[model samples]
Target: MAEDGRERLGIVAGGGGLPMIVANAAIEKGMEPVFARFSDGMTNDSIIGRSRAFAWGRTGDAIEWLKAEGVQKLVFCGTISSRPDFRSILPSFKTLKRLPRALRIVKGGDDRLLRNLSRYLESEGFDLLPVQAVAPELLAPEGVLTARTPTAEESAALDLAHRAATALGVLDAGQAVIASNERIIAMEGIEGTRAMMRRVAEYRAARKIGRGERLALVKAVKPGQDRRFDLPSIGVQTIDEAEAAGITAIGVSAGESLILGFDDVIDRANTAGLAVCGLGGEQGTAR
Candidate 1:
């Protein structure tokens, strides 16, 4: 438990409900949470009640505010889909020193970038904590969670999709795949899982698919991905998207992926006749 005066959790939130979940979990643990989100990343209505707003290039100011608030621990959550406008990123004298390194950071791939940012944050005296540090229950558990279970065919397809997704993770490409009858149908790209599922939905609508075969929506954690930032996370919307895409089963990396709104997600999946299962694997990559 944190002390009354000198301890607080600074939540650097992004787009999604996961940040709210994390904040609530921290609050339950007796830590005051300062919910801060980027100006462009607060697309979720859940962040509306109480929050601290910060601009993209104002890390120096944000850090000072958190320090003043006694927020010694920091947790980064949510999806930052928008690229920083370099023009707006003008650096002050204090932030000017970090700007060059930050610019170089953007040159690397996602994993490299996350690692660099984590290190930078630690160097600045803030303790970077994993999301699970505050919310262990958010981690997806092993085995099926819904009333429906994957059929024998969908089981095999899940295996195939998991393998393909892992291979793709090796290239830092994507974390999710859609498969049927042991054949890969679609893979998540930069457009993300929802968009990929929508594509599958369009295909199903156009061709009248699902010939008694289950569509498997498989999501895996990226191989060697920094858990502090991009651990694979799913919410209730994922279930609705999968069901709309004709997905009969959903498999995520057990113990590694974050299952936001787990109970509600499972309840909706069961009601929609979709199976939500967790698959085990190593290095956060589901097998």
Candidate 2:
């Protein structure tokens, strides 16, 4: 709690800008933001307010740090570039006590891992908050957000991409898929959406094709995913990457995905003459 007695939110920072964005948003809503950084070394030191860094296996330490900071609500945000090296994890007494459950988390896919992690944290007494709950305004509303609405072909491509994303989600593989010429060309993996975009760009350049109106990328939440962690998110960076990948339009699950820096994302998409739409339907519905 703050000196003013307001609750403080503990943000588990990862590799992207979303963590900071969430932290700032929490502050605007009168909640103090405390950070818990991981040993992956991806989270930068540009964070505001109090923070503590811990190794992947040091769950007990992290919980202690959050408790000390008076954080009762916690949210996980941003991208994780790599998985932890289990061999390198220095076992603390706390970690060893929870080894079996921790193993279950690390051994699963991204969605499973996060779901288990959220459950574990909540079991330990912290209120796990989802990104949408933390910042409702950041949720992408259903509509065309760009200066130009998607062309019929682009919209069709988006539909195809959405289906592909759903399958990807069901597999607990990833949240994004790129579609062009009525087919999915790529799906996001552990490397993340930006890396998948780069791969699409490479494929297009290599083939010297598919750089037209039918290309679209759709990002959506995995079916039955725990909303408290690893929600699909996009920002101005997503716009820039999609543009670079020769993607004609972008579709995101409405209310299920987070749009970091919403205005900046729209402006970037408009400037690039790219269509950005928040898709709504069975797949895009919020949990």
For all candidates in order, the CA lDDT equals 0.80, 0.83
User: Using lDDT as the measure, which candidate wins?
Assistant: 2
Give stretches of model 2 more than 4 Å off: 211-213, 283-287
Per-residue alpha-carbon lDDT of model 1 for 44-122, expressed as tens digits?
6576434677777677777777777777799998887766776786666656666777676665667777788788778
Give Cα distance to truth, residue 57, candidate 2, Å: 1.1
What are the C-alpha RMSDs, in order, of all predicted structures?
2.7, 2.4
User: Which candidate leads the pack in TM-score?
Assistant: 2
Task: Quote the RMSD, in angstroms, for model 1.
Answer: 2.7
Cand. 2 Cα-lDDT:
0.83
